[model samples]
Target: MKRTQARFDVVGQLGALRRYARSLTRDSSDAEDLVQDALLRACENRSSFEAGREVRPWLLSILHNVFVDKTRRSKSESLRIKGLAEMSPKQLDAPQDHSVRLAQIRAAFMKLPEEQRTALHLVTIEGLSYQEAADTLAIPVGTLMSRISRGREALRSFEQGRDQTSLKLVGGRDVS
Candidate 1:
């Protein structure tokens, strides 16, 4: 691909890449950093990319790998204290009712296992097809389907206040 076209292709996928990064990182600043790192790596390895293939999935895969690497490296870092030290006290204010539901959903989403969360985010939130999402995660399409199913089930259980672990096997056979 021509240099100009290559640059344009990478730039065109920036929004999707940023959204996926935000879903993965769950923090704006960290998402930005992840996007930047992925872009840099993509540009550096541009020649390795096939000319006619879609770029979004490639960029997302790079972002996922970058996040995994960062997580592994940060595992050895010392814990940092978190507090409201940087915030200035303000007068008490009422919370927005609409935001409360969204917050609860977001909290529930954050509680899901990383694999399931990634599958759900890629397919439901990012609007990727099953094959595309599977390719991005380097998993089989069937595996992706299973993860998405489990993730949705877990979210539904949370909404309905059901205990997923309460079911017991019957006659040495599994029962869900």
Candidate 2:
């Protein structure tokens, strides 16, 4: 029906939407998510899409709104995270507890399964979004998220046990 035609028209402008989103977001993965969010919005509300109207500008407006919404939500959080990233170089110049802690963390991370390790590294250390990391690993985003969650749990376990190799003197016997 007419709704179906509107939906098709909206889909037809995906290329233009992606370009506008990329310019607005300045990150391919973020742009992808923005376009996706816009498409979802357009599909959900396509009933309001007027007939005989150009779809490209509407889709671009949806994408811009989506990007603006995300920016607003992440503004405070990004400021804090960005501050920490900016401080990294100065922090590295100082010799502190990082030597032992870094080694222990690395050893623990190394013990993770390869899939989990790769997912964690890509999403966390490499600063890739879940979608980008999933694409890099050729796995579904759900699978990538599962691996990262499991990897984090394993790392938490190691930290809690502190390597689980220390012997404690108790009742005239060694307790591990």
Candidate 3:
């Protein structure tokens, strides 16, 4: 009965645990899993308690460490898997759509210099503010704005090319 009481006391912070976990992982399934793993570790290490301290933050610290350790392990395993020479050309010859407009847009974006691509992706795709994106990327705000401008111009050029090709296919009459 005492063990059950201890479990209840330790588990009472589950909601807070989940909230913090969600913030860290950004996915509900992964957050729930992280919370469960943290709780299990907390339970196992209950004897390490210093007797008069709040347990929530202590448990959360353990949870964060567990997540970091797990992420490192996963990355290490992925690196190992990538090292195997599976360089078969058959994989490269798979027939896929080369004419999809979105694919073309992605290809054009890939052709941009790296800085412009990063700025565009962070601002447009990730929806970060110019300032936030700049900070995240460790670039000056002016540089971020310049990169965004260049990226947008490149995209416009690509889109115009697609529109011209499409119009040629249907008969080159500019409807405007």
- lDDT leader: 1
Least lDDT summed over 10 consecutive residues: which range in candidate 1? 77-86
Over the stretch 141-169, how does candidate 1's per-residue lDDT look in tens digits? 99999888888888899789874543221
Query: How well does each candidate superpose onto the true structure, as a TM-score?
Result: 0.41, 0.42, 0.45
- Comparing candidate 1 with candidate 3, which one achieves the higher TM-score? 3
lDDT of 2: 0.80
Supply candidate 2's per-residue lDDT for 29. 96
Where model 3 places Cα greater than 4 Å from the true spot, the runs are 1-8, 85-176
Per-residue lDDT of model 2, residues 1-176, tens digit only: 76747555655687888888889889999889898898998889887777777777777777788888888889978999999898777534445577878888898888776888899999889999999999998999998898888788778778887553432222346454
lDDT of each: 0.82, 0.80, 0.78
Q: Higher-lDDT candidate among 2 and 3?
A: 2
Candidate 2 regions with alpha-carbon error over 4 angstroms: 1-8, 78-176
How many clashes in each structure?
Answer: 0, 0, 0
Better of 1 and 2 by TM-score: 2
